[model samples]
Target: MPAGLVALALGGFGIGLTEFVIAGLLPQVSRGLAVSEVAAGWLISGYALTVAVGAIAVTAATARLPRKPVLVGLVVLFVIGNLLSAVAPNYPVMLLGRVVAALCHGTFFGLGSLVARRLVPPERASRAVAVMFAGLTVSNVLGVPFGALVGERWGWRATFWAITGIGVIAAAAIATLVPYWAGEVPAGGRAGKVPAGDRTDSLRAQVSAFRSTQVWLTLAATALGYGGMFGAFSYLAYTFTEVTGFSSTDVAWLLVVYGAGLVAGNMAGGRGADHNRDLTLIVSLAGLTATLIAFGLLASSPAASVVLVFLTGVFGFASVPGMITRVTDHAHGVPLAAGANVSASNIGNALGAWLGGLAISAGLGYTAPLYVGAGIVLLGLAVMTYAAVRQAHARETHSSPNSARSPDRKASM
Candidate 1:
């Protein structure tokens, strides 16, 4: 692996840390900023909203710009956001800082995915993405805990200070290490890479990608498949306590176990996707749907619940690489489409959480979310099947004898 990938992962680490760490420090931030708990909670929702918007807008705005400089600029924005948060004097200021930082999240990952894929063989594209996302998993497993510890020992502001330093280091690494032509195909195509054709700076060009049926299907599958998995996870703590009969303290360790499963699954998913995109997605979603339903049915069995939680993480994240490749393939390698895919996932996150909350509010048992999640994922599978059928039909039409005789087809050939 190239050392540059490590640099990208480092940046991902800092970004992921700031995102998750806020959850742990909400009480401290609320008290420090002299705001109610609900106001402080906006920091997370606001960040998610900003990320969804920035993923498309920022990525499209920077489409004509050189990638390396764009990456460096993003890290700088992250540094400034963290610095402001470290010194924020009021609730509004802290919220402003979070929004600033959130603006770069989706675009970075979207562009970074392309950059990472260009860094290696086409066969290794998925693994490159996995390595980058590994940093995100590590942040959840390690960075969040350590960040919370710093907030407890020093102050919540201290944690932001530390993240600011991380951002600075990551910016330096990206500026110094990532090549200017990281994703550009060299002359003679010796790189075995497809050049990212044409600049997509115009909003019209970006919007045109949505006209493709595959793009829409991929987006729907992403929203439903990922949403279903996260829906169950969003209510994991409640399920553990009420259904599985785990204590509050036990939930923490079990969550760590789930996070570990995520890291392992992400890596494995990347490798599997490289070999077979469709099979990987099908097996992953089907497995996730089954796992969630089974967990719901066996909620009373503590032993089964622990194993199922871990499996949930595994099957849930295992679909990411396949989903990304599917959208990008259909978009003719448009980076903005990739960024929009990230936005779709965020939409899925909100949708899943909302649906899970609805189940709980309906006076349903804690296990009800799992069943709801399973049904949503099943819908994703249905969409995936439709996409496959459409793809096959398109392929057959292109290869049929009559189409081969067409003047346009002959000229292109």
Candidate 2:
């Protein structure tokens, strides 16, 4: 990988930190701000909502700008968001900082994928993107747990302060290390590789991406699929503590195993996607649904619960690349459409949280989110399977009588 990839990874790291760091600091923040836990949860909801809005709008507005300056601007937004969060004097002010930070979330991943593609050769684009996203997975494993620990001792404000410093370091590294490409292909491309000479082509010209139904379906998959995942994951610490009887310290260690699973899943998905995008999506998803349901059922035993959570992370996150590629494949020319998919992901995040809360309000057990999550994911899987079958049938209808003998590739479920 190029040194420039390091800078991209740094950007990913700051994003990773900002998104999950609040998990650790939530109790502290809720106490300090004199707010109920439910109200304090707005910090996450507000951010995810804002990010979903900005991912498409911001990325589209900047689609034609020079790559280097745009990336720099994003990093600037990242720094300011963290600084604002770190130093807020009141809860409202703190929410304001979070909103600012949220604006950077979707656009960075969208643009960052573009940058990663340009920094490496054709065969390695997916791997390149995975490496950058690894920063995010690492956050789940290390950043959230440690941030919680820091807040436990140093106060929640200090956690944001440290994140702010990381943002600064990330911005500096990006400015120094990333190469200036006056014209490079946007990282998210349709199908296979595009030539270097074509790298600087205008996103305006690729308007066809918006016209594809497959793109929209894939984007919906991201929202619905991840919504189910977060529906369970958002309340993980609470569940582990109450249901599994793990102490605070043990919760952190279990998350480490989850993180390891996430890391492995991302790498494997990249390799798997490059081979067959459809198959990768189907396999990852079926596994994800099974694991989530299993976690809910098997919570009776510490050992069973531990293993289920690990599999949940592994299967759940593995779909990320396939989802990304699936959207890009359908997005062909529309860079903003592709970018919009990132925001769709956060939208799912918020939706999942809301539905999960609904289950608890209705007096379901602590494990209700798990079952709720499984049902929702199964719904998403059904959508994908339907789309795949319809697409296959359409293809079959178009084939010539002579060519109809061609091998049938059943849509992956």
Candidate 3:
């Protein structure tokens, strides 16, 4: 792996920590800012919504700029946003800070995926992307817990201050480490002199990539598949306490176990996807669906629930690398498509949580979310199966004698 990937991973860690640590400190924020708990929760929802929008908007807006500089700028934006949150005197200001910080979330990962792939050989691209995402998994495993502890001992504001410092470090690291040519497209043998016309064409190409059915299918798969796991996860605390009979304290530790599974699964899945992208996705989704079903059926058993939680985390995240890679592959490496994939994943998260909440509101038990999640993932599995078949058919058609009649058929597919 390139040393620059370390910088990207650090940026990912800081961003992930910023996004997730708020959950543990919502009460502190609520008390300090004189806001209701429900209002404080909007900080999270607002950030997510902004992420989905900014992923595509910011990425497209900056498509003409050099990648390394843009990355550094985004991290600088992250630092400023966190700093704003750290010192905000009111709830609205804090929400503004979150929205500002979130503006960089999707774009960072989307562009970072493209940059990470460029840092390594083609065959190792998926693993490279996984390395970048490892920071996110590690944040769940360690950063969130540590940030929560910091919030408890100090104050919630202190956590944001810490994240601001992290953003600064990430910004400096990215500026110093990532090569200037990281995302540059040479123009007429010139290294970085992309003409205005070429820039316009680049934007057009990105928009045009969406014409492929496979691209849309991959994005849909990312949304539904990822949404399923997140939906169940949104209600996990209830399941742990009301259904599985674990104490509140145990819930924290149980989450650590689940995070451990995420870390393990992400790395393993990355490697597996490098070997076979479609197969890894199929197996991971199938495994996740089965795990959610098992978790729902066995939630009353403490031991079984524990095991299922870990498995759920494992299978849920294991699809990420393959999902991102497949979408980018189908779109011919358009950065906008990758951003769209990130947006889709966030949309999935929000949708899954809402649906899961509805099931609980309908008087379904805590396990209802798990069953709901499983059903959603089953749909994703079906979509992915269909996509794989279509992709296979396209490849076969390209290799046939009819290839001459349509040179762009493979690209269109």
Candidate 4:
């Protein structure tokens, strides 16, 4: 692997830490800022919303620019956002800081996926993407916990200070290490020249990737598949405490177990996808659905809950690399398509959380979210299956003698 990938992964770690560590410090922030817990919670929700919007907007705006500089600039924005958050004097200021930081989240991952793929052989594309996402998994397993520890020992502001420093380091690493030509494939077959087109044409070409039906199907699959797991995850604390009989402290450790599963599953899934993309997606989604069902049914048993939690993390995240790769593949590696997929995933997260909340509000037990998640994932599996079948049928038709003579034969799905 190139050192550029390491820089990308470090950037991912800082962004991921900034996003998740705040969850653990909400109480402290609420107290410090003299705001209610609900208001402080908006810091998270607001960041997510900004990420969803900015992923597409920022990525599109910078589509014509060199990728390395864009990445560096995004990291710089991340640093400034955290700096603001660290010194925020009021609730509104902190929320503004979070919004600023979040503007880079989706775009960074979207662009980073493209750069990571370009860094390695075509056969190793999925694994390269996985390496970058590994930073995110590590943040969950290590960064979030340690960041929370820092907040507890020093102050919540101290955690933000640490994250700001991380952002600065990531910015410098990206500037110094990432190659200038990464993700900058030009139409003239040149390494450094801008793609041969006016800015409008370049933007149109990126947007044109969405014309493929397969791209839309893949994006839908990504949303539903990821949403199912996120929905169940949104209320995991309640289920762990009220249904699984775990103490609050124990819940944290159990999450670490789940995070461990994320790391293992992400790396393994990437390797599997590189070999057989469709098969990997099918197996991982099926495994995730079954795990969610089992977890819901067996939530009352401590041993079963512990095992299922880990399995849930494994199966849920195992599909990520394959799904992202599939979308980019279907879109022919367009950066806009990558950003759209990221937006879809965030939409899925919000949708899942909302639906899960409704289930609990309807007087269903805490385990209701698990069942809800299972049903959503099952739908995702069906969509993926349909997409695969359609693509196969398209290939068969294209090869048929009768279809070969037809001028109106559709593009492959």
RMSD of 3: 2.9
Error of 3 at 231 (Å): 0.5
Local distance difference test, per candidate? Answer: 0.84, 0.76, 0.87, 0.87
Better of 1 and 2 by TM-score: 1
Query: For model 4, what is the C-alpha lDDT against the true structure?
Result: 0.87
Q: Please report how far candidate 1 places residue 191 from its true position, in Å.
A: 14
Error of 3 at 261 (Å): 1.4
- For each candidate, give its TM-score against the true structure: 0.92, 0.87, 0.95, 0.95
lDDT of 3 by residue, 1-413 (tens): 68889999999999999888888889889999999989999998999999999999998888767778889999999998999999998988999999999999998999898888889988988898889999888888876687789998888889999999999999999988888787674232222222244432286667766888889988988999989999999999999999889998898889989998998888888899999998899999999999999999899999998899999889998889889888887766767888999999999999999999999999998999999999999999999988887777766766788574335454334
lDDT of 4 by residue, 1-413 (tens): 89999999999999999999998898999999999988999999999999999999998888778788889999999999999999999988899999999999998998899899888998998899999999988898876587789999999999999999999999999888889888564452223222455232176667666777888888898999889999999999999999989999898899899898889889989999999988898898999999999999999999999999999888888888888888877766667888898999999999999999999999998999999999999999999888877777787777888876323222463
- Candidate 4 Cα RMSD after full superposition onto the native fold (Å): 2.8
Regions more than 4 Å wrong, model 4: 188-201, 405-413
Candidate 1 residue 16 Cα shift, in angstroms, is 0.8
User: Model 3 TM-score?
Assistant: 0.95
Which residue pairs show collisions in model 3?
Answer: none
lDDT of 2 at 365: 76
